[model samples]
Target: MTDQAVADDGPGSTGGRLTTRETAERLGVKPETVYAYVSRGQLSSSRAPGGRGSTFDAAEVDALARRTGRREQPAPAGELTFRTGITLIGDDRYYFRGVDAVELAGRHTYEEVAEWLWTGELRPGVRFTAPHEALAAARRAVGALPSHCGSTDRLRVAVVAAAAADPLRFDLSREAVLGGARSLIPTMAAALPPAGGEAADSEDTSAGLARQLWPKLTARPADEASLAVLDTALALLIDHDLAASTLAARVAASARAHPYAVVSAGLGVLEGPLHGAASGPAHRMLTEVVERGGAAPVVADHLRAGRRVPGLGHRLYSGEDPRAAALFDLLAQVPQAAPALAAARDVVATTARHTPLHANVDLALAALSVATGMGAEAGETVFAISRTAGWIAHALEEYGERPLRMRPSGHYTGPRPPQPLPDATEAPSQ
Candidate 1:
């Protein structure tokens, strides 16, 4: 076909396609970077028809090049913008600093993933250890909380106590924030009381956060498969692009709150039903589905009560959640997870006939908690712990920005008044 005829066709035409090398050259990047861009969903690639290398749409490539140029320009005055190198969400997948999050979770430990998110560098086999004083204070604060307090409440208290014990907590410098984050994550994990009132283990204090956290969520001994699932979940949950809680953290950091306070702000938002605590309802729903031996009745109950089904859909993804896909792949290896997993699948299939929503990370988390003998609130604990790394990453970014840049003028919508004042003796208006 002639090039003109090919161009007359749509973007799918061969004339509109560029090879990897061409795409790299057009974008002024290396071939490897082109692949990275594709993985990050900045560019999409499709296999050449028969048996050839990947091809990119020429139009798409040029558009991306234009975007790259525009990104270098500064924001206009009186406009607030947040530019981050942390996480990117697009094309039904999420990336952590240009690396595919699922691939990172599969290849690296949670600590390593957390480190990479914070510093953009990976140190394999690195471990986080809580300082003695911080752990002690956190434990004391958590212990003082009423037994009925939820995991998020205890975590909130733990963060406050840890901040109080750190003499250098107010330092917003990069090195100081990094030091605090490295110690604080482990402290949060170790501070929670062990399941069934078991005595704390000295050795657990030095373990990876996932190892330290497993016992706190459930009394069951950690097995190889279950531990793997937990660690992967933590790694995958590290950060999503400006989630509600992460935005809250950045807002606090914009005001120059210390790292601990940044995390506290995040935790405060995280505990709300729509954010971190979302998984708890999913966990309960999955449990009921398993016990009832069917998803229909349980799903019906949710609809009957006028409640949205939990853990089924995500606002950001039209397809399956990448995190859920990764965790479900790991969960398949755990023999104990089969029933819960099946129930989760059934819930999706059942709901699919009507709404066609895919299972989100919360449903996968619910399966993990149910299969591993964790309480309904276990997922919330896991969420709060995992997202601490993300919150700190955002704080680090915000600490470098103009202070209080997030503050905005309110657009008044209320009744404008200077007309009258209510008399104290007059009857109040209905």
Candidate 2:
């Protein structure tokens, strides 16, 4: 292939065809950096209707070179047209398509919120076609992961693995980006695979729907109350201001790292006990407390250690997490939620007496999920799975505001370079 053809073939390159690596080399940076450029919409490339990779119009690259002082910075293939003026924090109580996050969290299902962000419609009546093929494949990918892994693990591994599998992960086309996100749902379901196990192909939407998450856990069918509770929980946990995990996700997105990688970064960050993994521990503590007949006492004991309770407070939100209030309200509606709910409250009050910090949503959801039979370990997974909606949204945001690059500001903690060694040791021997 000509150099142009090769450039066109590079991931997301639109002109004559430069492979991402080739484009990066031409631009003088790492392959990952090329993705950041593309993600930021800095680089321009076109997707062939039915082609292997995006083809860049070489002329466009030259135009970009002139625009950004290419000699100084080889901007990636796709660069953002506008600075992401959209700062998520305190801009609103919530948002859905520049709307409200809390409102969507309460009113929308995971699918609906996703549809809203994926398109402007809060409930997309098919303004855009659903990527059924990609959805099916995502389901297969999730189902293919280790069935025994917790939902969080499965969700993480599945998204990462699936991205690795995508042929157009770097394609800059809007439809392609949306299409990739569509896969996360079924992939998540596939990863969960229920306690009894998910079939190779669960064709029914109801079967694969997010609500069905519970049936795989308990022997009983999911009641409307519980499903509603689950939906609300999923929604409330959807997105936060770009958190550390969110930043990690954006880092992956900056690379034009496939959505899978973005989610993987999320799942990985979720692995940290301070973030996504915090819910798992919170749930476990509550359960152990309940089992030991000392929920409050135990929390008080932990408090003496100068540790804030996990899932109780946050850096943001001076008000009760609206997400928590919404979920706790939903939890109240659950038929099974009575005593477990009571136990959680008792624990919360006892802990709060010793500490001014309050119970965050994670605490309530963890208790509620365990009460509902989702299991403590599943809390993080559920959080991972549910937060995926937000993750996808955030990932798209990164897609829009990308080329999220980082520069090191290292501390010179280590010793300086040593002075040159003296002459031959043979002199000492002599």
Q: Pick the candidate with the highest TM-score.
A: 1
Q: Count clashes in each candidate, considering only residues at least 3 apart in sequence or on different chains.
A: 0, 40
Clashing pairs in 1: none
lDDT of 1 by residue, 1-430 (tens): 1121222122233545767766665677877998899889899988766545678887687678766742223459975556676888889988887789999999999999998998778999989989999989999999999999998999999999999999999888889999999999999888888876886555456677778899888989899789989999999998997888999999999899999999999999999999999999999999999999999999999989999999988999999999999999999999989999999999999988889799899999999999999999999999999999999999987776556766678988877887588767977889
Task: Output the lDDT of residue 156, model 1.
Answer: 91
Return the top candidate by lDDT: 1
Task: Name the regions of candidate 1 deviating beyond 4 angstroms.
Answer: 1-81, 421-430
lDDT of each: 0.86, 0.63
Cα error, residue 25 of model 1, in Å, equals 20
